[model samples]
Target: MEISGIGSFLRNRRFGNYLEASFGVNFASPSKVAVKEEVEKKIQSVAFVEDDGIGAVLISWVRIVVCFVTMMFTTFIWALIMLVLFPWPYQRIRQGNIYGHLTGRLLMWILGNPIKIEGSECADEKVIYICNHASPIDIFLIMWLTPTGTVGVAKKEIIWYPLFGQLYFLANHLRIDRSNPSAAIQSMKEAAHTILKNNLSLIIFPEGTRSKSGRLLPFKKGFVHVALQTRRPIVPVVFTGTHRAWRKGSLHVRPAPLNVKYLPPIRTDDWTADKIEDYVKMVHDVYVKNLPESQRPMH
Candidate 1:
């Protein structure tokens, strides 16, 4: 079978360049296909030889080590400094938003990458902020930008992820266990109570997981339920360039500018469950459109 031009471009030009080949004579007779068989054997042997496997594993290991060390040192050093220099209340303030912002700035600068924040004018002191999930670094950026206390709605697994786990508990975080659907819903109900009682803002990723392709994943309705129950405002946040800057499969911090944009808040005062899905889709589309051309997810 012959491949089309586009197929040729995608296969041979894009990825087939790494394949092995057999260089020998080809006979004109029907029974003499030695070169073809030799080539097939070579192809099979080379096909399973992963060119990027070792490099990927080593890089992933290095990233884990670096991330662990950075999270530990930053949390410890900042907490210690805040404890020594401020009163109890002031210390809590520093530890929460201030320290987080400082940590993010330090990480970005040290990585020689800058994050630009725009559309902050739409940010309210108290509201539910929803953004596309892209990476663990999403936590730091959201906390840094939020003035009023921001509580993240994260998965239960995060409660066990190293320094992040301890900090999450310390910050009075909300955990949703998706494995048990009922339990997850109950957790969100409890979180709604906390949000209302404390007049605190919640940051949730409706997508539930980070996008490997950078495209907005299908959103879960748990966020809508919580928003409706609390009758709080919903602010849409778009995080651009985060995936390229720190992709899920790799650990090396590539230098790139990350952009965070805050859209106007949407209220649940008159929204119905039926239209919630439509509303969420619209917000996602808006985010996709507003994203910089270079950072927009390829469909």
Candidate 2:
């Protein structure tokens, strides 16, 4: 399919040249643009069921049943494996990656959603990932895109979940107490220390919670504080179409094309706590400008 609308605008050579000249931002190459176009074509070809008919309703119900069954079965198996490898932290983390990949593939297969990843490739080096939140599926999308040894930072409430919460704890992700400032600060310190000592990458959703309106929300400063403490490069990631696939507060899943794009990383060698809001606004603007008009916030 031909590139149009926001995609065309982003890939335009003149716009890229202007960005490079004005802000020193490097635009995607022609080869990358071609790849994106092909991916878009593939996404467009996927069959999506319209929710207006009884047949569609039945299909959606069946899909939910299959997804729930698959998730429960996978979580049980994953928990067993974690139990077996609990004695070794590094081994558990490595095995978690394998289980994570399998679960991600299984969930996507059941939903009939194809994930298209674009932009900067993830390397083995340690860094901080800041991403826009839209749906619960964002975690799975991130897992499928990132390499092994990357841990996520989640709220303390997630620990109260049943089987999934146990697995998350066993997976060794960082959990922060959002209700208490001192505890949250301590969690960030421990998270930074874990990243440095274990040589692992961390993913943080700066918005803190999923966006109900499918638009990027104002970012919280927790992620910025973590980046500053760790002195790591911040990689910004954006997710499109996930909210439509499995929307917030919705029980049904739909077939939708999901895209995960990784932007250039921002180095924090000379950043200070006083400049945190400015940096957050800068990254927020990147999402506002790059997201398609349909997905952009209605102001």
Candidate 3:
């Protein structure tokens, strides 16, 4: 699409209203009432539950054991394959993405959560993806929805996570040290370069960390710089219900509806370093306004 078209679309309030209506939320615009009602009926058909009990606790532990075993077995097998293909880094990384994707899907299936993905048609374009962080499963959710060449930008600490860390490294996902300003800057540069060099879409949680309150957190500015530096359009993705499925600091996984929406990409051709805050706020508002009120950040 032309840059002008993108600009016009982004500025179009009606489209934003339409998105809100699609999520079963009331929009200030009167024209969206019909759409809003339709979405509400659909949403009502799918039950949303929040349970914490003895059975829930037992189920959660079983899921953890099963998922852990599955991950370890799969990661070890992938590790062996990686060793054999170590001489061919590109092929190794490709295999790692495939392995990660398959393993993630398996885990989701085992968890028995019904996933409803929207705007998957946006996957055709390669762009920088900025998503809300709410659970550890956010990475897997994105991997399952996006194309094969997508990589994630994670914190440096994730490199020490057991089997998952090894797989993350083998997948060639970029990791940065949040504590070291200089290192973090370098990682951002590397992320931009990696996207251009590998022709892969990069996923970054601008929030920097998961939300403990299930509300959107203030975004970090590093991703803004990454988008401007790479000159790639920014695709705002929202993963609702993941926190309900697996809340932060919880070991149990609930069988909840998982929603993934890929919103339109905003062109970054005219973006500059000086407008970083404005850019961040624009995207942040898109998430805050679109999400259900219960999922939005508390004022």
| Span of 10 residues, lowest total lDDT, candidate 3 | 3-12
TM-scores for all candidates?
0.69, 0.82, 0.82
Candidate 1: worst-modelled 10 consecutive residues by lDDT: 14-23
Candidate 1: pairs in clash:
none
Estimate every model's Cα lDDT from 0 to 1: 0.64, 0.72, 0.75
Clashing pairs in 2: none
What is the Cα-based TM-score of model 1? 0.69
Candidate 2 lDDT, 35-142, residue by residue in tens: 456556655676655474667667767887887788789889988988888888765665565556566655655666666666746443578888888887887666
Clashes of 2: 0
Writing each residue's lDDT as its tens digit, candidate 1 over 29-66 gives 35535644654454334322223466755654565566
Candidate 2 yields a Cα-based lDDT of 0.72
Model 2 vs. true fold: TM: 0.82
Cα lDDT tens digits, model 3, 145-220, are: 5555667889988979998887788767788877877878888988888778878778888998889877899998
